[model samples]
Target chain A: MTEHVEAKSATLADELLGVVQAVEGVSAVYPAQPLWQSVAGAAVAAVTGEQLPLISLTEQDGTLAIKARIGVGSPLPAPKVAREAAAAIRRHLGNVPAVVEVLVAKIEA
Target chain B: MKTPGDALECGHSLAELSAYLDTGEIADPAHLDSCPECQAGLASLRRLSELGNELLTADVAEAGSGGDDWMQTILDNLRLELRPGRSIPLRAEDPQDTLWETEGSVSALIRSVADSFPGTAAGKCRLLGDITEPGAGITVDVEIAVVYGHAMEERAAALRNELAKMLQVQTELDIQAINITVTDVLELPAPAMTPNTEDQP
Candidate 1:
């Protein structure tokens, strides 16, 4: 007898952001911009408006791409931190074909 | 089949206009003003830039403040190596023990000073000159973004004075100059208003 389980319903972008934040050497994970925010921002701009979700995810050709802008802690090498963050992202999204790009936006001392 | 970098019918490419925007040194400034194609391209680029800024603002807002847990987690992972640039020697109580402050610290101090001012955000900051040598003449070059409607000249002057005073009090280096460049003018967000609840009868 096989037990049926319900698959979770949510965008992987948020999940990816949380996973990236958990990785060591990352000072801050940029928040992912939501679609609603974009629509609202457009409406706001029509009147008067102003925005970082540091992480952005896009899916193209069945391949997921993740872009994360992170703040590195004072004294940590940014390149190394970025590399580790990318690797952690891949690990977290196991079996899902993904391209992860990490950018060190700020260094916090 | 038009290539990606193909020139527009007016003979000017998007790349050229983008470069013109940055350096303001185009091959034919007069022609650019006269050309309809270039004008259209410039307008499109400007719109894209505006949208980009809005997206960035939204993303940052969602990320929460610097002290938030998301930021804290990233900070924890980053074991940043101290950038001890040219160190200035300090007068130590014990002659045998050497003391000095890093150039990185000075830059951080400059950033903090600029950040303390209202409606201003600090960007890339640099200390130009030989900082390792005691009493070395240094120039503080800071790039900042200001909110719209603020007096740019006054803000720059105030920042310079504040930085100079802080440097004088905090460091022993000779500050030759403080150069503040206003790189971007940011739009202030609309103030949040609480909904009126007294009308419910």
Candidate 2:
């Protein structure tokens, strides 16, 4: 006989966002807020009094893909920081076959 | 019969319309008002721009304020290197030891001054002209975003004066001009609402 177990997926993206945010050299995480989500979030917030998270996650070809917008501190090479951030995200999501992309939105001094 | 990225029957492309929206200096500004193709293209681009703004607002809200833990962690990891531009010599206590302030520090000073104002955030900043030479003529160019509801001209003038004072007090560079550009105007978040007492009644 085979048994099946189900795990809730509600908080997975949020957990990933927290981990990525903790990575060093990242100034600010780019919130990839979609237009529709903003509208929906406003409506929901009016009722539920909750805000949305900025990080976005998508499932593609059975693998999780994460996209983040980040600010790089001035005097640090943006490309290098972005690469390190992506690596940190992958390290946190062990064995998940995740793809991560970090975009340097602004260079903050 | 028109798809995005496709040129209109009049031979003008959506790309032209997008550029026109940004620069407002199209080749035929008068024709734009009368051409149906151009009108349609402009309408589509405007809708897209609105959607983009909405997305940015949502993202910024989600990111939280500058003091949030997420931003803190990123800052902690950064270990940013000091931007020491041209050296500006300072009076040294010891005859042998040399002291100087960095050009990067001046830029930082300008940014801080702008940021101190309510409803304003500083963006890219530049120190133009020669700074390596002592008493060199310098031009300060600062880009800033003002929150909605603030008077732009007043804010710019105040920031300019404040920056001039701070720079003079802090450094010995000859500042010839302070140019302020209002790059963006951000919307304030909607206020939270309380339960309506009238509705309960």
Candidate 3:
């Protein structure tokens, strides 16, 4: 991917991350990609001097695939939190054709 | 802390997390609060700490003093793994949007329920079934320890009722059973262990 595309993706990832974090039940947002991806992404970001967001954004087959891993706290169940987060992301996406996934990786104590 | 790969995805080490638990100090406290990896690590470490204390209490009670290898054994067994656990599918409004909850989170929720009891502490929890499939039949197996004075049967029954209600509200799984196993009965002063006659032989 070109620097412009990567930068744009990172920017959007950061935006979506903000949206997810603003959700009522989400207490934390984790780096959602695989370990190898995180390492490689860090390396790539270092060489290119770009800010790599924790949320993963990959363009596949012309569809922007976004994954956000989050931790939800009490007063709201995880399923509700995950759905709300995904819906918030979708609402932000608007007309953009993309696949959004949310994982409730931790339930807070 | 013993391994090179002890670092979390967010570039924080488990040792650092352990320190945060002990000293309540980290390079970036705000980051620890916002970072899911650190939060997960802290939650896990907290659970381990509670269980470890209970173990040490048991050890001290049995050995008359816990200056023994049992603590070493616990540390050796610390092979801590990030608790993403099994992923259970969730209903999504959009066809393309996928959402799921980790088994670790569910386990944490269940353990919290158990720990809320006056004289109970939660042990390991298992969600036995195809959690990846929505509405799949599953059995929740929770191991717990109760204070010596608490009635074991009553505690287990109350825990069962609470877990069923909580799981029904929190998860979408078709919970076939919520099994509460009272693995240990904790006594403030462990009963004196009789001398091992077999050791004499």
The runs of at least 3 residues in candidate 1 whose Cα sits more than 4 Å from the true structure, single-residue gaps closed, are A1-109, B1-82, B188-201
Model 3 backbone overlap count: 0
Clash pairs, candidate 2, are A24-B77, A25-B77, A25-B78, A26-B74, A30-A69
Residue-level lDDT of model 2, residues B44-142, one tens digit each, is: 345435534653665543322322332222222111111324555544332322334445445545655676676565666778887767777999888
Task: Give the winner by lDDT: 2 or 3.
Answer: 3
Candidate 1 C-alpha lDDT tens digits along B92-135: 33222233444544565566567567656566577888877777
Kindly provide the TM-score of model 1 when superposed on the true structure, using C-alpha atoms. Answer: 0.36
Residue B134 lDDT in candidate 3: 81
DockQ, all models: 0.01, 0.01, 0.51
* Candidate 3 runs further than 4 Å off: A34-37, A42-51, B1-20, B23-38, B44-82, B190-201
Error of 1 at A92 (Å): 52
User: For model 3, what is the error of residue B136's alpha carbon versus the real structure, in angstroms, after optimal superposition?
Assistant: 1.7
- Stretch of 10 with least lDDT, candidate 2 chain A: A1-10
